[model samples]
Target: MIIESTWHKSSYSRAETNCLEAAYMTTGGAVVRDTQNRSLGYLEFSAMEWSAFLVEVKSCDL
Candidate 1:
């Protein structure tokens, strides 16, 4: 069964139209996408992968 995700934007995002959105998948993973293009779809990442990505982003290493 395909489950819907609850998408959310970053609290730190500027008061602009363009931003990023993310959602947790029912499959124990997460998905991210651009707020400006919902039709383009999203990128999926495993829980572990998402954690590592968050670490790098916090460190400004991306």
Candidate 2:
């Protein structure tokens, strides 16, 4: 099967010019890319790894 992803950015950064965009994979993982450099391609993460990364990000103050 073929799946397509829709890239989106955080609502908090909607007014910002520089930010990152992300899309979800059908396999339960995610893909991320820089808004300013789409030509550079993106980074893909496995489902497990993505979940861990999100947990860490939420735990941080940043």
- The TM-scores, one per candidate, come to 0.71, 0.77
Q: Pick the candidate with the highest TM-score.
A: 2
lDDT tens digits, residue span 7-39, model 2: 888554554586788888889988888887889
Distance (Å) between predicted and true CA of 58, model 2? Answer: 1.0
lDDT string for model 1 (1-62, tens) is 23366789977666576688888877766898888788999898987898899999999998
Model 1 stretches with alpha carbons more than 4 Å out: 1-5, 15-17
Model 1, CA-based lDDT = 0.80
Q: How many backbone clashes does candidate 2 have?
A: 0
All models, RMSD in angstroms: 2.4, 2.5
- Give the C-alpha miss distance for residue 57 in model 2, angstroms: 0.9
